[model samples]
Target: MNAKTPDTPIVIIGAGPAGMAAALALHTVGHTPILLERYREARPAGNILNLWPPPIKALQEMGVDTDDLGAPCHTTFRGVKGNIRADVQIPDDVVKAYGGGFIGLLRPELYRRMLAAMPEGVLRPDVEVTAIEDLGPTVRVSLRDGSSIDAAAVVGADGIDSMVRRLLWGPSERREHKLHIIGGYTFADVPGVERNEVVLRHDRTVQGTYSSIRDNGRDGIQWWVLEAWNPKAEPPADLKSHALSLARRFPGPLAALVDSTDQKHFQRWPIRDRKPLKRWSKGRITLAGDAAHATSPYAAYGAGMSIGDGYTLAQELTGVDLTDAAAVVAALGRYDDRRIAHTTAQVQQAYVLGKVFHHAPAPLRPVRDFILDKTPMLQKQVGEKSPAEIVAQLDEMGAGLVRA
Candidate 1:
């Protein structure tokens, strides 16, 4: 890729949750990893993230105090035409058993917190990785500034449109699901909105919700609108107008919130997920987070999975000789084996749930609502995980990783 370089055993691309977690993981194992990001600074405009317990626990182990950023929330689902469908409350006992609670925090705050947790100078912002070469014995990562670094291994933690993933698994191999989503956040004095509750309204192609949440000790609201539409159809230029148009069909308070939200805070983008790849590693190169398993937010597990990947990867590489190419390959193989199942299940579920949330054809709407309303168990199974099962899994994941 470039002239011979000093051995930087691991080079992590991207500074999002996955990359940051991987850096911390490697550091915990006594490896000083070089983390690179394309942006000049952190872009934390993804609105609020609903991080689950498993990943929250992992972040706590890495020294992040999520409790301050978020509080536990009970989720509700509304059917077509703003009708209540089902509600899923995370029981206190389950929260106590898992030792972590489901939380919502502004994505920007989480991003800043993660960067702050890293050692100074470990994160190289504004440095873009132009290319990567997985040499038989080493990985050469090229940067936009005509510089390169050789590492025993390279991590493709770069987001969905990951350059490292493209380098390893050609562009044609990448895939995206057919879903469109546009939404944003704003500070509002929503009188009736409960601070500890988030709601989702599934109304045909227009499916979304707005919730009151605590951010930096201030009250704020976050909202989103998702729809199953033509992938190639152009998105509306004015997201605020689009959200407002959809809001016309929403309940009074929900519509008012959308109408009152500032146009500057409205963000719009298509929801895309990568098709499950048969493999996530080649030679000394491996992928993590969105680069490995980009999923639709409908499942709300993608971020958690990314953080877990980094933690589990660190666990896998704990005592392995980084210079040993065979060991690196074997460790990555195991990482893929461990992660593929969980992420794949989430991807499939997100796709299925996206369909369920959107219009279920004219004749199926009533049936869909009936089942959703009658089946508390179904909602429970979808959103609630057994605390005992979660704790046991966490114990398994924490077993091999080096402690902080």
Candidate 2:
């Protein structure tokens, strides 16, 4: 077992939404934390966005201002086929009821806001962590720089390829991982689109959608995302060629939008998912965010879950007796248990949604429309009800989450 030269009380690996959020939570509880990251700075490739009701309220309490980079979008549009459907008129109060307002922001802008909230010396970037050794009560992390800082606990908030999770789980866990080099460039003055709304255009062989970013006071910038699922193959080498082909799938003014897009300005990312790890806590170390559980974008819960992980983990950690290692581990167990149920439901539902709603089926379109028409609450239930409630609803309806 590797041991550490005792350092900070807590050290979070990866300084993205989850890591930063964890630091913020620690600060609120009056605990100073140390954060480390391999990237030079926070990566804001995706249009930063969060839709959950709970965390928005927490952010308000934290007093972190994001008005310069974020906006409350009251209207949302979602549906399928060559049709317009499901226009949701969510009022500000209604949005707040969920937890916080339905807010959107640029990723860089949000990163800036999070940085301002933390104390100096807490955030460390551009340092790559190579390994984590579970040394009984605490974990000893070895960094590429050849120096290490030990902590009472280690957080695996690093994105999909988390180093902490790799060591703790070993290299053999069958958590299916895949990479997708998808890109999105910010564009101003996109025509025929409403702000604060996401518009999806379905092509039988492909799918296209544009979601609005928070108001930057200029013309709003929208992200056009393309997703293709292929498990065994590697991402294409020629990004522009593949991007152009992906762009061609969308007709109407979108072709022009894609043409106007700077493929070079686009953000590409690999995709990975864990089959709900057996446990998130091993003694004093625990997993948070993607390291603990990564969901497919089909659920759009990555950011939400990251924030939730930070929120709940903080709540549990602050309440637990930190002096007692067993007590600390138990508190983390609660964090893991809570996150697993919440995230697992999302992963399963997202896989089902990708097939049912995303796929353009001429035969099933009418039936889907009819089902949606009959029970708009099926979608409603998923959002308004708890995860346990969602499972119960599925049982009551004699329905089950679809498999990939």
**By TM-score, how accurate is candidate 1?**
0.89
- Model 2 whole-model lDDT (C-alpha atoms): 0.62
Error of 2 at 288 (Å): 1.0
The model with the greatest TM-score is 1
lDDT of 1 by residue, 81-169 (tens): 65556555555765664332566768887887787788777888899887788787788888888988888788999888887888888
Worst 10 residues of 2 by lDDT: 395-404
RMSD of 2: 7.0
On a 0 to 100 scale, what is the lDDT of residue 381 in model 2? 40
Model 1 is weakest, by summed lDDT over 10 consecutive residues, at: 383-392
Give one digit per residue, the lDDT tens place, for model 2 in 1-404. Answer: 13433333677998887898888777666555788888898776465354544444444334455444455554332443445444434445545544224555566766777788877888888988877766656667778989876666888898766777776777545344332535464555666655665565544434566565564564354445456557577667776667667766665445555556676656666555766677877888888887877776655557767766776777677745555678878888887876777677777676555556545467877777666555665445433443334233222222211111
Any idea how many clashes model 1 has? 0
